[model samples]
Each structure stands twice: as C-alpha cells, then as structure tokens.
Target: MKAIEYRLPKDFDKSFIVFQETGKFFPCPWHYHPEYEFVLVTKSTGRRMVGDHIGYFEEEDLVFMGSMLPHVWVNDAVYSSGQATHPADAIVVHFLDNFLGQDFLSVPEMEEFRKVLRLSERGMALKGRTRRKINTLLKQMPPMNGLQRLSTLLTIFDIMANTQEYDLLASPKFVQNFQYESSDRFRKVTEYIMQNFDQDISLPEIASVASMGVTAFCNFFKEQYRVTFVEYLNTVRIGHACKLLAENDRHVVEVAYECGFNNLANFNRQFKKFKNMTPTIYRKTLAI
Candidate 1:
C-alpha cells in the first residue's frame, strides 16, 4: 500500500507543465509528487482518494493539490474491464512552489494566491461558477503561449483564491502523518485506516500502525498534524457518517453505530459540529 513518489517529465524550454490525458482509465495509483497540481476531469466517473480523504468523483471534478500531497482517482469497475463506450479525458497543470519566484506570492497583490497555496495542503475540490471559469480558461490555454498562457494561469489562481465554492479535502491532523512518507509507516497507516475505519479505531491501535508507542505517537502526531489523535479519528468517523446519511436508507442511529459512533447522542453532537447540521437535516438536503 506504499504510495509511489512520482517524478514529472522535464522540458528545458518550459517554465511549467500543462497537459491533457486521454485514456480508457486513470492509471496512476496512489502516489505523491513535489509539484503543486491542478486537475480537471472532463469525462469519467470514479472515486478519488486524497490524503486521508476518500470519496466519489465524476465529470467536472476539479482539484488543486499542494506539493507532496498524495492523490488518485480510481474509475468505476466498468472502465476497468476495457469495454468502455467513451474514452476518459482530463487537463492537468503542474508547477513548483517557487515557480513564480520565491517572493512572487509574498507581494501584497498576490495575498489571495498565497492563501490558495496554503489551503491546497488539504487539497480543494472546486465547485460551481469557479470550476466553470477554470474549465473555460484551461480549454483556452493550449493554443496560447507566453503572456497569454501566463495571464490565463494567473486568472485561474485568482478565481480559485476568491471563490467560496470549494471543499477542503483532508483534515489538517491527518495530513501531517504523510509529511515524512519515505518510510512505509505512513503508507501502512493510511491503508490500515481505510480498511478498518468502519470499526472503532482506538488511539493505541492506530499508533501501533504508525509503529510508535501510544505516548510517543501522540507527540509525533500532534507535532506533525497539529491535531490530537482522537480529533483526527472523530473527523474520519464523521466523514463516513456523512456519506451514509446522505446515500443510504438506514436509520440515523443505525448509521451512527455503523460509522463507529458509540451512541446516538454523541453521533448527533459530532455530526452537528463537523457538518453544522443534524443527520435528518443532512439527509433532507441530499434529497433536494
């Protein structure tokens, strides 16, 4: 389950990388790279795994990921069988943190752009009008060069930074665990969590997955992710509960227990804290 650290292709003449991918399926496995990445899936339906987050994805899926963040999109089984009716397509952009010069983003004019970069550590799923704007610019980029290319890119960043229509992909606490992923320990932790998050995940158990004593693990996790181990667990459990509440017909209490929440009261409280709504209200919104 260890993720591959990917290396981007180099071109001596280029300042950044912008390209399109068309295929029967998205082939890259769970992987990480140093360059910040922006991607738009124009045609496909699948599930996306970003950092500690797991969720479904489909056409118009647009995401921006920070340097060294891990991500992947696994297409549905129909695409895997090689008998798909339509080819998959996507536009991807890659640039280094200092691609625009170390001080470029520090300028006051680039303040919002800086925030986009910082928030990208958790990844961002662009939505609504912002996604539409970026999609249009990306389509216009391939045929343009020099200032045209550069200006369009800046515009895309501006839209992303100013727009409110986006979802942060991963929890701050969970992201730190991936900071030092050279060792397989981070990989093991992620794989173990994804496989077993449905059941109760205790601090001691998850700490063992990271190969550290519970106390040492606590210190390490806190320093790395800036969140206590228990808070991270609750975030994961709550995220799972949200999916079930929106997509399944189960009773609220049943969804609570199934997502590893101990009692109905606690489940309701955490759901409200995490989602700012009750389970029934969340379900009703989904129905809309």
Candidate 2:
C-alpha cells in the first residue's frame, strides 16, 4: 500500500519532511517512491532489502536510501505475532532532489552537499562518530521551524558530506526494476527464511509459500539470484553466525549450530566458501 495510503508533506512546501514513526513492526511492504529518505532505527532488528541485496539489521541502524531504490525494513515476523515484547520505532527524514529549487545545489557554496547527494544515490549507512552526530541532529529537528529547521537540515547534510564514517549499502551496478508479482512472491519466501533461518525448513514447504513446485521454485529462484536457494539460505545463516561470533567469545562449533548448520565441519566449509575463512579465523579478525 502506497500513494493514497501513506500521508506525506503536502506538495509545494519544499523545506524538508521529518517525523517519527512507531508500530508493531515496519508496515510498508517492499516498495519505492520518488523521495530520497534517511531513516534512523531506534528499535527493532530484522532483514533489510536494498536493491538486490538482502541482509540483517539491528537496533540503532542509520541508513539513507536514494529516490526509487526499492527497499524495505522487514522486521522479524515475531514482532507482528505479538511475540515481540516491545514495539518498533524510527526517526525518518525525506526530501526531493530539488527541494530547494533545481539550481540551489548547483551553486559553488553547496559543493559538499552535492557530493553527498551523489554518493547517497547508491544508499548509505552512517556509523561511528557520524552516526552519533546525526542521531543528535535528528532528535533536535522536530520542534524547530523556518530558518532554524533549514539550518538544522543543512548542518546534517554538511556533516554527512564531510564524514568518512559511512558505508554504501548497495553495489554500484545494482539496478532494481520493480515487478509487483515477483516482489510479492519473494516477500513470502524471504519472510519465511528470515523468520526461520535458524531452524530446518523443508524445500517443499518453502516452495509452497510461493505456490510453486519444488523443482520450478528452485530453478526460478536460482535464475533470479544466480545462486541456489540452499546457498542463499546458507549465506543468510553465515551472516548471523558472523554477528554472533563478533559479539562474544562463543565457541566455533556452537556458533555453527546456532546459525543453522547441522555440523561443525559443514559450517566451516560453507563459511569458507562464502567468507574465504574458517570460523575460528573469522571471529579472531572480526571486522565486519
């Protein structure tokens, strides 16, 4: 649901649009719109899809997505099932490319802001000191008006332009051309994976989620992603495994099973295939 379903700042008022949203979980289905967006996740953890990339997200995640990039912050399904003890919350900011007029950013004084806009086209994740600075500015924005609001917005952009403490989210080559049918099908399949990736899920059960036979679903999914469904599931598991490994001194074998691998040897082999390192070496180097 989009367009008429969601309220936005009225057209012709071009300063900026900022607000706080809270819910059982992020409810917007995987969708895209023309506004460039910056979101601060104050609470919740789940999968985030940007362009063709899929990955887990957690609390305090701050990200910028370019106009029409097709993305979603899908909370773990339990949140909607009344299993999550707390609700989700976020501070969201949005604006158009030419909100200040087409020529405003072309001026020499706005050079850094222009660079930020360009880099943000690939999507961005602000981390470390930059994220801390933004979190402050975001909290300070809602009560301000007129010149104060504009000033706060400029300061936010200026900080983002100057910082090296950010990572781009999507690949440079990634392009998403939306097909509603495919998005709907994958939504079911991916939600199933994200909700149950730690448990053993049968291929037939997963195929049924998309209303396809196992062979057809396997072939279709592989062609779309260029990796088998099992491989993709392993990648997701390995990602969570890396998170666990980084957070504590969990033993490698235990981490493997915690992430859905049936055995230590198999987990090691898959981890090596995806990450080019064994679990022991991975946790030791833990830079991700």
Candidate 3:
C-alpha cells in the first residue's frame, strides 16, 4: 500500500490565505499542517477521512479542521474511476493560530469568536442558513484581498459562532499522530481498505499490503491510527452501511450483504454499536 500524498502550495510564508481550486488531482495523503484549515466543497462528491471520522461528502459541504488534524478527501470512484464530468472544485482557507495576533482573542469583543476557534480542534461542519452565508462569502473570495479577506474570514467565524447547526467530527481520543512521518503507509492502508472493504479483510491480508509481518503490522497500524486494523475495517464497513441505508432502496438484509456483513444480525449489531440506532431507525431519521 502506498501512502497518501498532498500537493502543498508553493509559497509557505503567509500565515493566512484563501484560494480556489478547480480540476486538480491533488490526493493529499493523510497529513496535517501547523495551520488550521477551512474547506468548502463547492463542486464535488466523495469520501472524507478526518482523524477518526469517515463518511460521504457532497457539494456545498463545509469543513473546518484544527491544526495538526490528519485528514483527506478521496474523490469517489465515479470521479477517479474515469467517469467524472469535471474535477473537484473547492475554496480553501488556511491560517495560523496567531495570524490575527494574541490580542485579537483577548479583546472583549472577540470572546465568542475565540471560543469557536477552540471548539474547531475536533473539526466542524457549517449547516443550513450559515452554509448559505458561507457559500456567498466563498463565491466572492477570488476578488477579495488583504483587509477584505481578513474581514470576510472574521465574518465567517462570527456566522459559525452564532449558528446552531454544527457538529464535531473527531472524538476526544482521536489525537493527531505526529510520529507517522511516512504518509505512504497510511495512504496505502486506507486506500486498500476503502477499495476492498466490501470483502472479508484479514490481518494477514492487510499486513501483506504493508509488506510487514502480522504482529509488526498490528503494532504499527495501531500506533498510527489508534485503532486495530479489524476495528478500523468495521468502522469503514459501518460507514458504508450508513450511506447505503440513506441512499439506496434496498432491503436491510440486502444492504447488509452488500456492505460485507455475512449475516443480518451481525450487521445490525455492529450498526447499532457504532450508530446507537438500528439500521431501520437510521433510515427513518434520514427520511425525516
């Protein structure tokens, strides 16, 4: 398995910046940076892996990732599988914690904004009215510069602070693995799992992909991802099941089989264990 690689910007001096990307195949491997990032998926649909979070993503999705949080957005098979109409489109903003200076957060006027940035450590998604507002701001991002860009960013934070619809993506225990220097290993493991998640995955098989012995691979994967290979496979399978439940009109048993679970009872058990709801309940919630 190969590691995930990211195409970083050429200029690294700026602490805060915003830019637009279109039709670029930058498979940013599971990596992180010192600066926090805000990404708006203006035109794309794919799977996102941020820290311990994994799920499908579509157009208009807005994500904020804190500094040092490993993440990546893999284009769906429809796109990378050589059938895409157009490449992914995105507006990305990156800024350091001190880009606005220490005094900015200390000021009484910016207390709410300060809190929002702190909460962003786990990653967040903007929803509903706030999403619409952010979309408008991002559409005008190309023309904005200097103070205008700074102000627009401030307005984005303000909107996020006031919005009631936002959810954290990563768990408290899902800390960044700074020691995982070789992103190739991470990318290879994940891509293999994503591609073969519908089949029975075994430690020996995955270890072979990593080209290491079973015990060595187990320790290495656990150290890097903080989850055993089997556990992570289950997470991916359950995530696929969730998507199938919401988007497909298949029977529960059929969905289970398609998602790689051998039996309906085992699928239901795992789904409820991870989602806290049965597959039927999950479908019902999505319908509403």
Candidate No. with top TM-score: 1
Across 4-110, the per-residue lDDT of candidate 2 in tens digits comes to: 22437643554678888898998887677778888888888887766534556788888888777778788888887768989988888888878788988778887
Give me the overall lDDT of model 1.
Answer: 0.78
Q: Clashing residue pairs in candidate 3, if any?
A: 2-188, 3-183, 3-184, 4-29, 5-29
Q: By the lDDT metric, which is better: model 1 or model 3?
A: 1
- Identify the candidate with maximal lDDT: 1
Better of 1 and 2 by TM-score: 1
- C-alpha lDDT of candidate 3 relative to the true structure: 0.74
Residue-wise C-alpha lDDT for candidate 1, range 119-201, written one tens digit per residue = 68888888898898898898777678767877889888888768778877765544653433224775676567666766888
The candidates, ranked best first by TM-score, are 1, 3, 2
Q: What is the TM-score of each candidate against the true structure?
A: 0.66, 0.58, 0.59
Residue 239 of model 3, lDDT score: 70
CA error at residue 57 for candidate 1, angstroms: 1.5
**lDDT-superior candidate, 2 or 3:** 2
Once fitted onto the true fold, the runs of candidate 3 whose alpha carbons sit more than 4 angstroms away are 1-15, 24-26, 176-288
For model 3, what is the alpha-carbon lDDT of residue 191? 73
